[model samples]
Target: MFIAFAGLPSSGKSSTARALGRIMEAETLLEPEESDWPLLVQERAVMGAFTALTWFRTVRVPKLFRAEDKRTQGGSVIVDSYYDVLIGDYLGKPAFNWLMPTNDPYFDAASAMVREDWNRLPKADVLVFLYLDEDTWMDFMKKRDRDFDRSAQLESHFEMQELMLQASRRAATEHHTKLLVIEQRSGSPEDTALRVRDRLEEFA
Candidate 1:
């Protein structure tokens, strides 16, 4: 199963994915440039551009990248991304938040880009949305130490978190796929992992 974990940056998606993989001894594939996206966005911001024409190069481009890279790797391939979000615009997020500058020109470009990626995603097996309350979200974001992130972004994240939760509700009804909102506060990694593990198996 291509288990994709989705949420805002620093919301513990990667942390949870890695932990789950370690516990299950599963294979995993990651968006290799994730660590650099924040810095890249900051670098582009100062120059007034996103420089994301490169996203056109998804590892699974052409919709036939490789089942083997995932399939033969192990128990299941877990991934972390801001994509796979349960929204009409999930595909446009990296662009909206990281690319387009909220102009007609940018909006038009983003629309085109969204349609393309929407075509690429398979009927995904499972989507896990990691949610934390406002205080917990801020705590985790601060701990990561990304200098460009600001309070305004956190406010915007607050909005997206609500929107994504709503989106998850819609997806559950529309697609009837598993849309688990595993809360990430309240305990240790091991504690949280067990709850997530139970949900994953129901879908897997």
Candidate 2:
């Protein structure tokens, strides 16, 4: 079994993924670190180059899936932020222009190339989306106290978060995978994980 957790920033994805991994005794793949990619790739702001890197990282997902499949032989694997992150953060961004662009040959070519491979990536058996109402999400963000959390424009952030949630839902439906939406405003991480585990039991 493979479970991928998707959500906006500060929406409890990392904590939920960790807790569920513990509950299932599954191997967990958290979000990839900056060190996981080449430094040049990390520095690139060129839309085409960034888009290509996103696809490159996405391609590695299935390999990890297969490796864990063999290791567990049928056990669960919990992914903190899988392809949905790419979709929400990169592909969904108009600024990134990953889908289509006018007059930029490289961007168009890269978009097509990545889209082809993106469609080939395997869907998770269960995609769990963690979200909160705007007020709750804002409160969580304020508590984190990150630099960006303090400095970035909240209006834009809220718009993007809502877009990402919608995109996640579409992706789950398009892939024909199981979708679980957990509201992260009312419980502790363990409580949410227990609820998720109970939901997973239904699929068993």
Number of the top lDDT candidate: 2
lDDT of 2 by residue, 113-193 (tens): 547644665567788888778888877777655543343344246555566667667667776768888778756788889
Question: By summed lDDT, which 10 consecutive residues of candidate 2 come out lowest?
Answer: 147-156
How do the predictions measure up, each by TM-score?
0.74, 0.72
Question: What lDDT is obtained when candidate 1 is compared to the true structure?
Answer: 0.59
The positional error of residue 197 in candidate 2, measured at the CA in angstroms, is: 1.1
Find the 10 residues in a row with the least total lDDT in model 1: 59-68
Cand. 2 Cα-lDDT = 0.65
Candidate 2, residue 118: CA error in Å?
3.5
- Model 1, runs deviating above 4 Å: 33-40, 46-50, 53-75, 82-99, 169-176
RMSD per model, one decimal: 4.1, 4.3
